[model samples]
Target: MDTYAVHAEGLRKRYGGKDALAGFDLAVRRGTVQGLLGPNGAGKTTAVRILATLLRLDGGRATVAGLDVAKEPRAVRRRIGLAGQYAAVDQVLTGRQNLEMFGRLFHLDGRRARQRAAELLARFDLVDAADQGVEGYSGGMRRRLDLAASMILAPDVLFLDEPTTGLDPRGRGEVWDSVRALVADGTTVLLTTQYLDEADKLASQITVIDRGRAIADDTPDGLKSAVGGDRIEVVVGEAADIPRAWQVVAGVCREAPETDHGERRVHGLVHDRVAALTEAARRLRDEGVAVEDIGLRRPSLDDVFLRLTGHRTAEEKAGAAV
Candidate 1:
């Protein structure tokens, strides 16, 4: 109904003396996927729980689909869907059975429940596995069924918390396709994940959070620009050439190149990728500095995350693991 499907301002949460969310703010636009990126204990899930009306906030305010989660949780619940980190389907039940059970819990009549299950089965491409017990389903199929369960009411907004954490590449791709289909049908989504590539592919905008606070928010390109321009990187064939390689890269790029002594690598930002690449190669050739590798590449979301979070998402593995 509103421009934002979900909105939060100054959200605060506390567990004993430790803060889970500290004055956090976020906005997810309608009909778009907004990646809530953060390391473990960075308040990504805390903010989601507050907006989803599953947990009470100590301070601040949030709303979903134009209804205040705090003042009108029932109204918000009717307009939102939530799929947590793990698949939330029954192992003993058939894929179709799981959908029907969720439909019944949502108050659909028996006929309507069965019909809804069939619809979800087809929608998620689970028709072949519909009658099969979830126990035999692959990780991807089970997760898809879990997502279908969340869509029982076809809520306006969906909150996906690391929908593909443990899946292999193929399984993760399946979940990604399902999410894309939902967005195509105009569902707004808030996705949280540690996989930078997932956000790079699916999120129209990204919000970077750390230490229970909002650190950066923007489109993927915008966030990457915050780190620096295109990078010029070189690996010298000989360790002794590292210093000279750095000088060449720094002189051409006009920035000091960062060196990895162990790898004999030097990298830094550059103004023009094509020109920088050509010039660096030529300079190395002229200077007799043999290079093992060289390239000009754009900054990835991983670079942006490291610049903002001060770590390579290591904290998320144990704490959030998203």
Candidate 2:
């Protein structure tokens, strides 16, 4: 049995003199969530379109579900499902009707379409509201319905392009749960998203792309560790206590702490997380420094992105616009 559901090597796509994908490569293990994390316009959607056969690659090779994408486009389409940034369901139709419509569009006969629709409605937890018009459904519900529509044929690999974009916390969580359930049932997922936390939470392995190329790829924990170790942060209650607090943290961490006077915060990296926090707290108490909050934390994905890409994802997005 093949270990990878999707594999790409030196994939390239050009848009009017600009390369949307420049030598991009990926390997997504079967039954696992592989995150393609990058800023806006980082060729994430372009890569997905290529693999889904919606767009052709200018160079390189790719295979989905063990079929060469270029040579066996039809076969690749059969084994894969794609849900883009927006929901593609009709608001005027009921959830069940929309799903059945998709089933029929996929060439299923009337009886099989209904059966598949019923099965999907139950699988996606839309049974209670299955009969209601989709216009009344919440954002999460609509996205879930979109997900169900993509699963009409129970694809082996599902490509979710920023699936939770523009969703509220609750709505994003709902979609996350749905994704979890899909992977649990042996579906491989290639999730492309700008949300760092979303990638951290859902992906087993992450490939960080920048300027249409991958710069780093690793597990969430491995990426974090690559950037640095834990950090001790202190927020002082009074602006006047900033210096004292910084000194205290610096002493505990054995390094100069970075201080933000405007925010009255001081933080520094540390090797021993618990010991640094303990000593910092004790020293702050002894020095009469009025501390608002103090804690130890590992490097976040935001920090890792900044370190690896030399800018946050938002910065990259803004730069891309100009």
Candidate 3:
């Protein structure tokens, strides 16, 4: 068996004067979820489009499910399922009809299409609502239906581009479950997501890109360590106490602390987790700084993004527009 489900080398694409993908390269192992992360306009969507055969690359060799995406577009399409950032199903169609329609589009016979739809409905837990018009479905249900439709032909590779973008927590959880179930059944997944928590929870490996270039790649814990080690964070009861709390945090950790006056929060890294947390708490008590919350925690993906890219994802999005 091929060890990789998707492979690309020095992929490049240019839009007028700007490069959308600059030397983009990636290898997704079979039967695992690989998270593709980056600030906006970092070539993630472009890479997906190229690999899915929706857009042709200017330069590079790429393959999906062992077929050259450029040379064998139809074969590649047959073996891949893509659920993009938004739900693509028609509102008038029932979930079952949507799946069946997708199956037929893939060239399945009428009976086979209905069978595939039934199977997907059960697998995605949409059997109860299978007959209901998608117009009546909640955001989560619509996403689930979109996911189900993608798998109607049980493609070998699945590309999910921010699959849970607008979902509430419950809806996100449902989509996550659907993704997990797909992976369990031996589908290789390449996921693009803005939600660090979702990627942390689902992705087996994460690759971060910036300015259309690959910047970092690692597992969730490994990526967190890139920003810093165990850090102490404390929330002061009053915004006026931010400086005092910062001083206390810096003194205890022997490192410069970051403060957010609005939240009255101060945080700094420490070589010693226990000593830092305990000492910080003791000093805050002695200084009469009322504490709202405190903890020694590892860096989150958000912190990693800011530290690596020199800006947050939201700021990156804004810059992309300008």
Candidate 4:
């Protein structure tokens, strides 16, 4: 059996006059969630399109389910399902009708289609709303219906391109549960998302893509550790106290703390989390600096992205182009 469900090497694709994917490579193990994270125009969607056989690569090679995407597109399509950024279900159709329709499109007989639809409804926790028209469904419900439609063939691999985009926290959580269930049942997943917290929560391994190429790949904790260990964050009570707090944090962490003067926040990486927090608190108290809060926190994926890419994710970047 192939150890990797998806693999690519030196994959390239060009659009208009520029390269969308320039020497990109990926290896996703079977039965695992591999996160593909990048900003808008970072070639994330292009990579997914290539792997799903929706678009051809300009150069290099890719395989899905051990079949060469370029040469065996049909065979690859048989083993993989793709869900894009939006819910693709028909609003006029009931949830069951939408799934059954997809099943028929995949060539399942009426009985088998109904059977698969029922199975999916129960599996995705959508049975209660299965009879309701998709137009009446919540954002989470619609997305769940979309996922169920993708599973009609019981594919071995699933490609989700920002599956939870535009969802509220509760809706996003609902989709997260569905993804976890799919993985538990042995589906290999390639998840592309701009939400750092979603990747941190759902992906076993994450690949950071930028400028149409992968720059980092590791488990969530591994990536975090690569940037730094825990850190002390101090929120001073007054903006005037920020400079003093920064010095105290710097003294404890033995490194200059980054300060946000507007927010009255000073934070620095630390090797000894507890000791640094203690010393910083003590020194700040001794120096008559009133602190609103002080605590130790692990480096977030956002920090890792900033360290590696030197900017915030595209959604947070002001004046970021689509």
Whole-model Cα lDDT of every candidate shown, in order: 0.91, 0.92, 0.90, 0.92
Residue by residue across 170-249, what tens digits does model 2's lDDT show?
Answer: 99999999999999999999999888889999999999888888899899999999988888999999999988897888
After TM-score superposition, what is the CA distance of residue 70 in candidate 3 from its true location, in Å? 1.8
Q: Which ten residues in a row have the lowest lDDT in candidate 1?
A: 313-322
lDDT of 2: 0.92
lDDT of 3 by residue, 157-176 (tens): 99999999878899999999
Against the true structure, what is each candidate's TM-score? 0.95, 0.95, 0.90, 0.94
What TM-score does model 3 achieve against the real structure? 0.90
lDDT of 4: 0.92
Weakest lDDT window of 10 consecutive positions for candidate 4: 313-322
Rank by TM-score, highest first: 2, 1, 4, 3
| Candidate 2 segments exceeding 4 Å error | 314-322
Which stretches of candidate 4 lie above 4 Å from their native place? 315-322
* RMSD after CA superposition, every candidate: 2.5, 2.6, 3.1, 2.2
Put down candidate 1 lDDT per residue, 1-322, tens digits, no spaces.
3799888899999999999998998988999999999988798888888889999999998889999999999999998899999999999999998999999999999999999999999999999999999999999998999999999999899999999988988999999999999999999999999999899999999999998999999999999888889988899899999888988898888677799999999998888788889998999999999888898889898889989988786534455664
Judge candidate 1 at residue 144 and give its lDDT.
93
Model 4: how far is 122 from its true place, Å?
Answer: 0.4
Model 3 error, position 185 (Å): 0.7
User: For candidate 1, what is the TM-score?
Assistant: 0.95
- Provide the clashing-pair count of each candidate structure: 2, 0, 0, 0
Better of 1 and 3 by TM-score: 1
